[model samples]
Target: MTTHPTGTREDWLKARLDLLKAEKELTRRSDEMAQRRQALPWVKVDKAYRFETEDGPATLADLFRGRSQLLVYHYMFGPDYTAGCATCSTIADGFNGFAVHLAHHGVMLSAVSRAPLAKIQAYKKRMGWTFPWASSSGGDFNFDFNVSFTEAQQRDGGIEYNYQREPAWTAQGIGDTMTKRGEGPVAENADMTGTDVATYTRERPGMSAFVREDGVVYHTYSAFARGLDGLWGMYQWLDRAPLGRNESGTWWRRHDEYERQA
Candidate 1:
């Protein structure tokens, strides 16, 4: 027998109707937020950022592939990471499906990582993703966007992420634990990426938007942390399920990690 609460049909209907009103209110608020996002002013980008794509070198504008708008997912695959971050990999698993559709609709979707081109290509192939991915290795693109931090920045805790300054992990008492898992988010994902906590943390996950108009590219918007919840395909589905996310810590891994499911 299930442990969930049971009730009469009329009782269930009453509860569901109440939830439906709240759901509609949430939907309206979400629509308002979308309008606000669209109304935000676009800041012109002057930096000459370059990236290494599968097809030779390309500029940030080139990633749009003739589209007027571009979306870049800041994947957390640092230069020294042996593998991609598990959480990022899971988030990206849904991209290949919608990327083609987005391109057709005048928007381009791609991923940018601090890893080398070869590493990014290998991981993309392993994950069977056909979307365009670029490498920002040896470039200041990630750091300038506040998605990456230097050792000095991490040590001093003077970096801004998710629109606020966060204390350095070291200052927060996050020790380097290469072999330990389940200690915390930093340690767990660090182990999954086959790197130390600090190295894995140097790169953070985010998404940035750009718009090209009349030979100029403008930075339109960016979102970090839970701001990206809408873009995460899995969570959208889970939110509608009876039990919701039902998460207790990180209970997910790279799609390929569960070989038995394959």
Candidate 2:
């Protein structure tokens, strides 16, 4: 016998109707939140940052690619890692499908990582992805964005992420902070990426948005951690399923990792 509860069609209809009301309320709240997000003031970017792209060296503004807006995915491919983060890769797998649509709508979407361009190129080819991936190797772009941390920052617990400073380490433990997260995901993802825990923990996944107007680039907004839940296309689909996310742990892998089974 199935463990799931069985119910009559009428019962399901009554329950679903109640859920529908809440869902509609959530939809209204979501629309209001989006408007508030767009109302945020844009901060002008005056720093001279550079990135290595397939077309050659490019500046932050150049990433616009003639579009008025730019969306950058802060891919967690640290300089020392042998592979990109599986979680980030899973998120990126959906990018290729919608990237062109966004481009046509006057937005340029790209990924930035700290790995060397050659390493990034090799991996991108392995994944069969064509989206524009740029290398920030030897640049302060990642550091300035607070997505990448230094060794000292890790040791001292001085990293600031999600616009807040992480708690200092005490004899009790790493205090109330989401940065460390847990050893399970951290160690598992680190081993998958072929790097030590420290190396993997130094990098985190994030996304940033910028707009260019009147020849000035302005940093519009950024999201990290759970803030990026909306962008994970797989989760968006899974959420509608009967079981929802149906997740317990790190149950995903790089897209290519599953190819052999097919």
List the global CA lDDT of all models: 0.88, 0.89
Clashes of 1: 0
Residue-wise lDDT of candidate 2 within 158-199, one digit each (tens)? 889888777654433334243244456666788889997767
Superposition TM-score, candidate 1 onto the true structure = 0.93
**Candidate 1 C-alpha lDDT tens digits along 1-262:** 9899999999999999999999999999999998998899999999999999998999988998999999999999999999999999989999999999999999999999999999999999999999999999998999989899998887887779889886655533433342233266667788889987778888999999999999899999999988888888999999889899998756778898887534
Q: Candidate 2, which ten residues in sequence have the lowest lDDT sum?
A: 170-179
Clashing pairs for model 2 are none
Error of 1 at 26 (Å): 0.8
Candidate 1 lDDT at 163 equals 92
TM for every model, in the order presented, reads 0.93, 0.93
State model 1's lDDT. Answer: 0.88
What is every candidate's alpha-carbon RMSD to the true fold? 2.8, 2.4
Give candidate 1 misplaced runs (Cα > 4 Å): 171-182, 260-262
